[model samples]
Target chain A: MGKILGGDNMKIVMVEPINISMMKIEEYRQQLEAEGHQLIAYSSRAENDQEMIKRVKEADILIIANQPLSAKVINASKDLKMISVAFTGFDHIAMEACRENDILVSNSSGYANQAVAELAFGLVINLMRNIKDSDGAVRVGKTRKNLIGNELFGKNFGIIGFGSIGQKTAKIAAAFGCNILVDDHKQHKLGEELGVEYLPIDKLMQE
Target chain B: MGKILGGDNMKIVMVEPINISMMKIEEYRQQLEAEGHQLIAYSSRAENDQEMIKRVKEADILIIANQPLSAKVINASKDLKMISVAFTGFDHIAMEACRENDILVSNSSGYANQAVAELAFGLVINLMRNIKDSDGAVRVGKTRKNLIGNELFGKNFGIIGFGSIGQKTAKIAAAFGCNILVDDHKQHKLGEELGVEYLPIDKLMQE
Candidate 1:
């Protein structure tokens, strides 16, 4: 009988830590390791860049987050079969090199869409109303007497890149009585659906 | 001409500082004093109870925020007229005493509705995703492996009160893909409009 690469024969390496809320990197490590695969994970940044390249060179699957997997690093992937990104962008990976080397690259796309959207809404509200400043002033034995804040209600909120995150932000802004103006590469029906006005990128920027 | 009981002729007192956004206490003091009324303000809490009473006493009008105006203090109001509260709650003040002395009490009702609503949303996002903990862990040389967090997406979020704040919270929650179940004293059409289901207090608790 011939040996297969399904289990213990394969080596998997995770280059950096990712938000566990979006993707459970540690759990994956434990599960993959338990299944008889050799798992090596750098849960934090590598102190030495050479050590990182050395680690990934022999990997069958490379799961990474913020840490860079440069073209030079990708060139050393003699046994590297796949690169899995735990974040939105694959810019850190050398895509051309991966293609030439017949390496598959996947990403945890839109995993943090809701988180990012909610945060965007939170920040706008916080800035307009000076919530952070108010908390700071109180801590410093001063009231908002010196600070006058504005409300988010009835203001124009401009959103660029009307993707999942932008769409979610528009909805929340609508609830706060904000007039939402969005700009994106594609004209989406979501704007009209959410009572948002779509504008050209240049116009949106000017507005 | 005889001096009438205009601004300059009346004694005014401010029990505490209020948000300049809500109402400028200092500005009011200056304006009232300029208009000819005598103004006394306790920008900070009084060290002595007797001193507090003295400040509240003999004033034609008192502007306060969360400060107690006990019966003893009201009794000292030899010429007390009105109590303007810069916050929603009036229970802090001796309402019965104010009524017995024919003193009118007014509060800045619903002044912080937007601020509270915005903050409520911010906190829920932060907690659900372990944002603060993640930031802290990174600063302390650790990754999210030590902390696994959940997303607000597709979560059932129950709001106990369906007032302004609760409704606002629901609006933001809806934006985050949360199913909103609200329990309130009254049924509002806004619930149906926002696609939020109204549940009984007990049912909401169980859910």
Candidate 2:
């Protein structure tokens, strides 16, 4: 296999990586090693900065998911050329260090947009129907003392920031027979398609 | 108020009824009393046959819900001309004594069909999402360890009875993106309207 950049095998380290991927860490390691790169992965969170520093000291590539990649860890490594985060947000990463070191930063952004939307709708049901409260009651054999619930068959649901996440949430709410109202800086086809009316943010807040 | 037969006010007794009714027992009694029928509503269960006998002694009409109107209670009252059960089922009341004494039995059937159906669907989401278990976890500050849950995006749901309750559950399931299969003695328009498939009892059991 031709080496990347025609140099010695590149060292890759992933810190506190999660199992949300389709492939396991070992399989990813094997695939990267076959392509002439060394892969090191920590399946669990590092206890301290020292532990994180030790793992990424020789890494040419650093991968992280959700766990904070503090400036201390990033400054400890001069060899890192790229920081890969397996999530939509990059706020937890030390972007300043990467910029100073000429390191590239990439994230799997928009990957969980649909998932986020689905959970929002589910949580609404969870809250309205008193699901969690009733469950605790059942466990203690005191079910329904204060377990009265409200239905979501015909309810008003408001959405802000009508992006992918907001659009997905709207679809689920539509299925629930909810009258969805959206307020955003820019309008999209999602509102008309879902039969959700676009209203002024001020108007939405009042009603 | 003039009586129907120029007779004294009718004595009516309700024994240990439940709160599953659409209208509260007191509210129904107030409506009945407004129409000149005497209402004696029990707020608690009758412990023994004598207790039940004492409650319905001079009653011209009897009302019950969930509590057992034993044969002894029925035989004790020769004045009863009607049994006004505040629910759909009549299994708890004594049918034999009513037959012998020529007493008319009536129940408030289909009163709670919508409420029952709405709750049934709410419970499905409650169970699938582990909302209750997670709530218990959060209450004790053990949030989300071994409390992983599944979404109801696409699943197979089987309904044993396609009456109001089952059909209503199917509608909610469809909202949650489920493929519904119903098994009943007779075919129903509910399946067609909801785009659910009706399967034979044996076939449904296998699938």
Instruction: Tell me model 1's lDDT, rounded to 2 decimals.
Output: 0.75
Q: Mind giving the per-residue lDDT tens digits that candidate 2 earns over A48-76?
A: 89998998888888788888888888899
Best by TM-score: 2
Please give the lDDT score at residue B129 for candidate 2.
60
- Two-chain complex of model 2, DockQ on C-alpha atoms against the true structure: 0.25
Q: Candidates' interface RMSDs, in order?
A: 3.0, 3.1
The model with the greatest DockQ is 1
DockQ of each: 0.27, 0.25
In candidate 1, the residue pairs with backbone N, CA or C atoms under 3 Å apart (3 or more residues apart, or in different chains) clash, namely B7-B37, B8-B36, B8-B37
* B40: Cα error in model 2, Å: 1.9
At residue B75, give the lDDT of candidate 1.
83
